[model samples]
Target: MGAPVSVTCLSAPVSVTCLSAPVSVTCLSAPVSVTCLSAPVSVTCLSAPVSVTCLSAPVSVTCLSAPVSVTCLSAPVSVTCLSAPVSVTCLSAPVSVTCLSALVSVTCLSAPVSVTRLSAPVSVTRLSAPVSVTCFSAPVSVTCLSAPVSVTCLSAPVSVTCFSAPVSVTCLSAPVSVTCLSAPVSVTCFSAPVSVTRLSAPVSVTCLSAPVSVTCFSAPVSVTCLSALVSVTCLSAPVSVTCLSAPVSVKCLSAPVSVTCLSAPVSVTCFSAPVSVTCLSAPVSVTCLSAPVSVTCLSAPVSVTCFSAPVSVTCFSAPVSVTRLSAPVSVTCLSAPSLSDVSLSPSVSDVIISLEVLASLGMDIQPG
Candidate 1:
């Protein structure tokens, strides 16, 4: 008996058996059941339901306002500023858990688990698992009502926020940036290089086989078959990209990139740079390539097909179809009333139309 045992305003059931001395248990709002073995334990301002067990010294737990459950074996465990639903388990030392606003679950078997600034709804699992995991400023807010978050095998750098339940991220090989406002997010087997930003839900990214760099932003995004050697960039939503089987480089600045190529070799670049590309659909057969294709402020509809390459179309207002021009083909229609179907086949070398699209092509211009 080294003389220091203070249990203030107790209701019932309090046990303290110290062999070497130094044990201070303070309960301000009562309802306490405290047990300390083998000295050195400090617990302060506990509202209700506190269980502290320290074997072989050095355990400090502070400020548990409501609903707290802590269990530490073999010392060295520090838990700070917990509001509600906290369950901490430390088997063999080295665990620092910080400022959990509400609902947190932490477990460290062999040490090294750092969870930082989580604002409600959290579940972390590590079984000999922690080779650099850094997650910063996870924002899930809209009254914060949708919950179900899982992060598995995170090999450093994870930033997540998906509102409206249903977020699953698996095997993130590193470099993952995700942002979805209306929920419904699924990213699977990403071998580094994944950047997703969608505002209105309905996002599905599957089996990104490797060598990945995907950038998507808004308007009902659906990207499928991101095999390998992938680089996709979509800006203004209303997007449907399918089966981009290897060697894909697509860049759409003001929305309207519908490129369908089945036999590989694709490089589609549309940049009005200032918002006014209603539609640019490149429908390929064997070879339909545009090296220098530019449409400055086309309202709608400009379909071009070149067998040997080089087809240039510029339309200020709708409907101009140029077919199978061998090489060096140019069709310019400014405020087209009606080009009335311009068809030129026989290895078209050079054709230029500017006189208001050749007087609206009154005779259905057919020169082969």
Candidate 2:
């Protein structure tokens, strides 16, 4: 065992803390089976904000690949660096990142300089030499479920892109494309990219060159309601929507309609099941009123097609607001408003009349 080296990194604007200690302790000078001895150490600021780098013995402790964003941070903290038999604390002057020992490292990759978050190319040069770290960008999170925690996920991107010519690092449209270009120093995985989308359009939708690139993530071609009176549930991941819920009752382009168990400790069964709830539509779109229940016009004359099971709509606001529903739309049910008596407003009178007229002619009034 040898006396480990120490280094500290101050917050940005404050240049890196170098291991400038002149104290020299030669590891070779020790006797046979010699006890730990201090070695001459040199700390360099590979980059600002990053405090110290013990050049003597490569102190490879676990590092955070994902930006550890602590919203509840009370004060500035220190990120300590460690070597076997001894540990070093690199103080990042009253800054937030307090790296507690939460992970382990298997290998250390060096290019004179290190970097992270490569969406576009941003380069760095260290060790009195120049090197390149071409990093790729992903649209979503990649999970290495079985691997260690050293996995690389570019929350955003920067690159050591300065070169003689343009070096193109393919930016993946999806998380699955994050394969090692050459070789990775180490890898880790948490939760992989889960497929979530609106029946109409999905947010956080990745940039893809092909359709159904990942079929698991594809939005349903269409949803239909087979019954006028139906009960729909809401579900998220790993919950099958096909089961226990009607189709198309869950309209896309609506509100933040998501699937959740009618009750707590909800047990999920199939893939599309329980029920799917997501705020799909926009301001001019149909907004979900309740849990797979009611909906109203966000603006005027909005059309909404349900995606879940048998469901109905009961207008709560401006009953006579919506004008011409050009797109095929469905009528929702009143929440627990027993059908004792209900009447369409004068504004909605023509809508119901014309629809009935079209129904007689077998004309489609809603988006199928």
Candidate 3:
């Protein structure tokens, strides 16, 4: 048989063996097995499990209702499973697999592969050079026991556990958890929270949610949380954190940093090195331990405290408090609300307070 043959509507189990010819088998309701020796084969099944084995020619298998298993020895393989689980194993050539309903498991011993899953979990174990996987509905778990991997998830949570190669993950709807044991990782979350814990590499996280929390513990971390009720904490790394809403808190234990809070009721705390913090609304507090600190508050009821370095505090509206224990302190209060309080205490250094247009009873001091 050297010509193309097409078979349709077989209600019993169908078995095909083709040699040096093209074959197209379709509309089968039972189990189908196809073995192509040297020619290409295309198999489509309606409600049955399909098994395809290709020696040196390409194979394309499409299943609508049952699980599909494809094994390719030399040429490329493309498998599409609509309602059931899919398993694909390729030895030398590339493979492209698409699954719509159930779980998908793909293992490529050698060769690059691309896998996409729509409604269930995806598990990919690649031992080749590179792999790309995308998941839409359920959680995705990828174990890159070998090469570099790039994963993008849309609806559910994403968990990437990488051992040696770098991983990049992007999530749109649910939480993203990345545990990088040896390589660097970068994660971006749009609607849910993000958690990253790295053992030996750096991490960068960005979260955009209404009440999102970002926690990073690694070598170097940069976090940006862009909503209300945001809390960012970094331990044992150089951290640069930015919070863009009210009731925000930024805390760093061991690094020099710059923090900016764009709403009211904000707090910034640093342990070592110089820090520059800016608050754009009222009820702001800045506390520093060992380095020089500069704070700017645009609204009322501001507090700045420095333990071992110079403090520069600027307040645009009233009820400001600036206290420095061992260095010079500069305090500026612009417009005081009615019954506002301005208290400045510099223990061993000079204190300067410039109050402009105090609408109520306030204190003004000028050094001559």
Candidate 4:
């Protein structure tokens, strides 16, 4: 019923070895009828008809778009599906399923399994055993009600459960965890820890609930949280934070750290650790960390956290940004000062510069 299919390897060395009793020998392929043995066997068919039956043997099977029906009676197996739909039914066998850009459905009875699917929906139902499932870009629903299970879903939602074993689920949206007689863990919504338990374990948990740190400099309004620690550095500008529940530390040249705090302390340092701001009703600790810098505080009882070496600002009105200057100092002004207004020290020498004889000779001065 599907499109044209290619089966690359199938060998039937001996003709029909038909027996009512279960055979346990490796067998090859025929165009329409291919049966294998109890020993693990590999079969490849190129544009061959799809009838492959293996009795009591583990198998590695690959088919391109032709409905592949492989029944592994009792053994472990691995299946990979690409671009086409594949349905694998394993009876009392441990299985590993990988689906890439295709829809895959797997049903296993009394087996432990691990399934990884990318870009498509993969539904796996395992009755018992430890299960690990990871899905990317699409939804993955797994129901394994026997052993420990861990599921990670990225950019999509996931629903997973383990009855008598622990279940771990991490997804983009709200993830639900239901278990009895076992511990359960869930992480959802931007690295936020969410825990669910009816009576024993905590019913709900959300951590790093808000953006940890946000910084914007010379660009459009941007906000980002660096989880656990919040540090913002702005140039000579204005920075405002709505609610900062964590310890707020700021070190800037001339910028102001204005914050309305509901729960935590605000610390600001400026200059060499110059500008320090302490605000709201919370107790604050401040450290002047900069040198040769200007400091402006807008609150009371300012404390220093830590300070480096001594720093001095020699010139402020001219906006001179040098900590130390070397001699000899040369001075030039937009408007020249009068000779009497200029005072020369003992180290200064006055040389009489004259060009009278060259002007008398009618020679013009030009920069070569």
Output the number of the TM-score-best candidate.
3
Q: What is candidate 4's TM-score against the reference? A: 0.46
Cα deviation at 224, candidate 4, in Å, is 18
The global C-alpha lDDT for each of the candidates, from Candidate 1 onward, is 0.54, 0.25, 0.75, 0.46
Report the C-alpha lDDT of model 2 over 1-368, residue by residue, as the tens digit: 23343424343232222233332211211111111112332322322212223333222222222211111111222233221111122212122112222221111122222223234222222212222232344222222212221223344221211212111222332232222111121111122222222221111212222121111122222211111111222233121221122212332222233332111111111222222332222122223322232333221222333233222333322122222222222354222133222233223423333343344334478864
The CA-based lDDT of model 3 is what?
0.75
- Pitting candidate 2 against candidate 4, the one with the higher lDDT is 4
By lDDT, the best candidate is 3
Model 2 steric clash total: 70
lDDT string, candidate 1, 1-368, tens digits: 66666665544545566655667777766545455556676666566556666665666667667555566666776767567566677766666666657565676565555555445544554444341222333322111124444444344445455555445555456555566566666666556555666565656665455554456664545555555554566665544445445555566554555543333344555443221122333222112343334433244455555454556666566566656545676777666675464455555356665556776556454565
Q: Candidate 1 regions off by >4 Å?
A: 1-46, 49-300, 303-318, 321-337, 340-368
Q: What ordering of candidates by lDDT runs from best to worst?
A: 3, 1, 4, 2
Q: What TM-score would each prediction reach against the true structure?
A: 0.36, 0.25, 0.80, 0.46
